[model samples]
Target: MNSNVIPFDFDGQPVHFSLDGWLNATKIAARLGKEPTAWLRKIETLEYISFMAEALGFNSVPGTELEEIKALGTSAPGVKKRILELSKSTGMVRSRAGSSGGTWLHPKLAIVFARWLNTRFSVWCDLKIDSILHGEMSTRVQLDRACKALEDRKSQASQDGKGLSSWRWDRSSLEQSVGYWLGQVQMTLDLDAA
Candidate 1:
């Protein structure tokens, strides 16, 4: 799980995306001050309502059926199974349990959830998730690459006897290296933010 996880932060809280690009819905829900199970149940309720409306016609649901649907909640019978079916069919939402467990969602549902939480948050979530899905490198990864490149440059230079002394005289080269790395970092950040 760790091998496939790509983690990022929003509003200072950590969120993760799988290598296949599934966003960790649980983390985002927590960041939004929502309970994952309750939210899922809400989603299930909406799905059930939509199905009923389509089947029975909107505003034509029988009173008893409407009441039963309204009563559907976290403890509703077969709700988990229905949710699982929904996940299997649509691939939009998923729930995992135990350690490393949380609801994971496709970017589409995640954006919807974010919108339900807050408009600004939804926009941020949309951009971030879209960036991840589009294969943009995370800022952390970009920074790491830049740092490693700089280290490699220094090490290669140090292999010669001059070492630090060489850098003192080769100030232009050093400056160029620093400028390149800084630009890389900036470009990565800008891309991720986009």
Candidate 2:
């Protein structure tokens, strides 16, 4: 319902997503009969945190600093602040409150959550998120682009004195032949019926 949230049809279910490809982890977790907090707890491990930090373009913290960061714990004020900092700096995870409010995860991390949820769902999540991030084209649009490219190539070939004979066709003749064949088939069917 929030203007910032976009509704996505995911396998017949509507899921909210942010404009920058942040997936609504809360909604997905609920749909999958799991708690977002539970999954969050699972991923909050040092290994996952370090991987996420690096994947999000953050430099690896030194050993002592990393230990200090780990000590902040899930419920600590520092942990909340750190989550906010990570959201602002790296767009890793975010939470908001409203009708559409939920814990949103970056596409990268969303796939991790999906993998944690279900394998098939994870593959679908990966592809859907990928298409969202990288502008998906309709099959018709792709076909049109391919046709245009072929047309350009054909034109070049004609100009180079290597024109393709098979590419030439009489559209009117083709249409007339198709129409006549259809009429003949219809008449035969009508006669058989009578």
Which residue pairs collide in model 1, if any?
none
Residues 52-155, candidate 1, lDDT per residue (tens digit)? 44554343224554456557744788855555444334445566776557877655566666666678877877776666566445654655565666677678
Compared to the true structure, candidate 2 yields what TM-score? Answer: 0.53
lDDT of each: 0.59, 0.59
How would you encode candidate 2's per-residue C-alpha lDDT over 50-164 as one tens digit per residue?
5676766764334564456567666765564554444434446667788888888877778887888889888877766665556433432443344455556567657754344
| Runs in model 1 lying further than 4 Å from the true structure | 43-90, 135-194
Worst 10 residues of 2 by lDDT: 185-194
Residue 20 alpha-carbon offset, candidate 2, angstroms: 1.4
